[model samples]
Target: MKKNTLTFIFAVGALIFFSQLSAQENPLSVGFKAGTGLSNYRLSGDMKSFTSKMSIGGSVGGFVKYDLSSNFALQSGIDLYYSTSKLDSKVDKSSNKLKSLGVEIPLYGIVQGKLGSGKAFIGAGPYVGYGISMKSNGVNLFKNSNEAGKLVMNRFDYGLGGIAGYDFDKNWQINASYQLGIADLLKGKGGSMKNHGISVGIAYKF
Candidate 1:
């Protein structure tokens, strides 16, 4: 029994050591990640102050990384982003919720370094999103808001984001990021509503 236990321990140690070595040698990788997180927009308009609740949201996506040197790489990907937030107004006695579905593309300039048996990285860059659909309280907000039936939101959104992460092994990693919307979503309205949120997720490399 003691011999069998010793063998198992050695095997685990060997597996970890080799995994680290393999990661160091590889300069390029592709991976997929999926996770849920909290989301809320930077509100505007007269009722913007009433926005209080953050909605739960998530993304499923894949990324590609290409090393530029020992300490830098370019990372980019497409992610399916879904987010919602709740708005309540006491003065008007109104409660409403906003939801959006979009596809996002991000290009990050990442700096990577070795951290003990793993690797760590930090990145920041610009991102763009195109909305697939948007709604408020089960009503299509993209539809006519005026008597002429014109769209209210500009479908394109652009932002900046920062990310930091650690890769535990060649195949597993965890990351967190924050995004700030730079472009207004309002078509021609005076008020400004922008997207901004943070996300944490796990990724697997192939």
Candidate 2:
């Protein structure tokens, strides 16, 4: 009877050691994700009176994440975003429309917690963007001008963002996030641009 008990203990120790080794062998995970993003720009201070409306547009991007532990990781990616807004002037009788194209890069560190069958994660990071092009369309509201030139927006912008996501398994996830701009995208000091959106996509771990 004593010999049988000693053998059982030895078997349990071996099982635990092998399980730990298997986990270490698969520590790194990589995946691809793409989804639609809704973007809008907000004006600040006195500029709010002139541009009361915010623009809404779509964005898509791909990302790569490296797992640092079971509950933490670091991720980085690139995205293309489009946005448009309408400006109505109370003083003038007409309105103007603006469209902008932007490229953004984000670096984030994430912390995760497991809940039943799904895992939830939260992340915060900084992002930088460059405006590639901008155009204005509409009737000229300025009193002296018959036509308006193409809109020139600030090329460089920076912001902070927060993200929350849930993973159903190792290969699938959905997320929602908010981003606030700290730098002005418009050439002058008129206003700063802000964006918020939700996205759902599939991720494959390798």
The prediction achieving the highest lDDT against the true structure is 1
Judge candidate 2 at residue 173 and give its lDDT.
84
Which residue window of length 10 is worst by lDDT in model 2?
138-147
Per-residue C-alpha lDDT of model 1 across residues 75-145, encoded as one tens digit per residue: 99999989888767657767777788999999999999999899999999999999998987566776657
TM-scores for all candidates: the values are 0.81, 0.71
Model 2 agreement with the true structure over 1-206: per-residue lDDT tens digits: 99999999999988876665566546556666555555555666544555536556666677877666667778888878776667665665456776667788888889988987989999999989887766666322212343343234567778888888888887788777677778765543545444434444445454
Instruction: Tell me the spans in candidate 2 whose CA falls farther than 4 Å from its real position.
Output: 1-25, 138-151, 189-206
How many residue pairs in model 2 have overlapping backbones?
0
Quote model 1's TM-score. Answer: 0.81
Worst 10-residue lDDT window for candidate 1 reads 142-151
Best by TM-score: 1
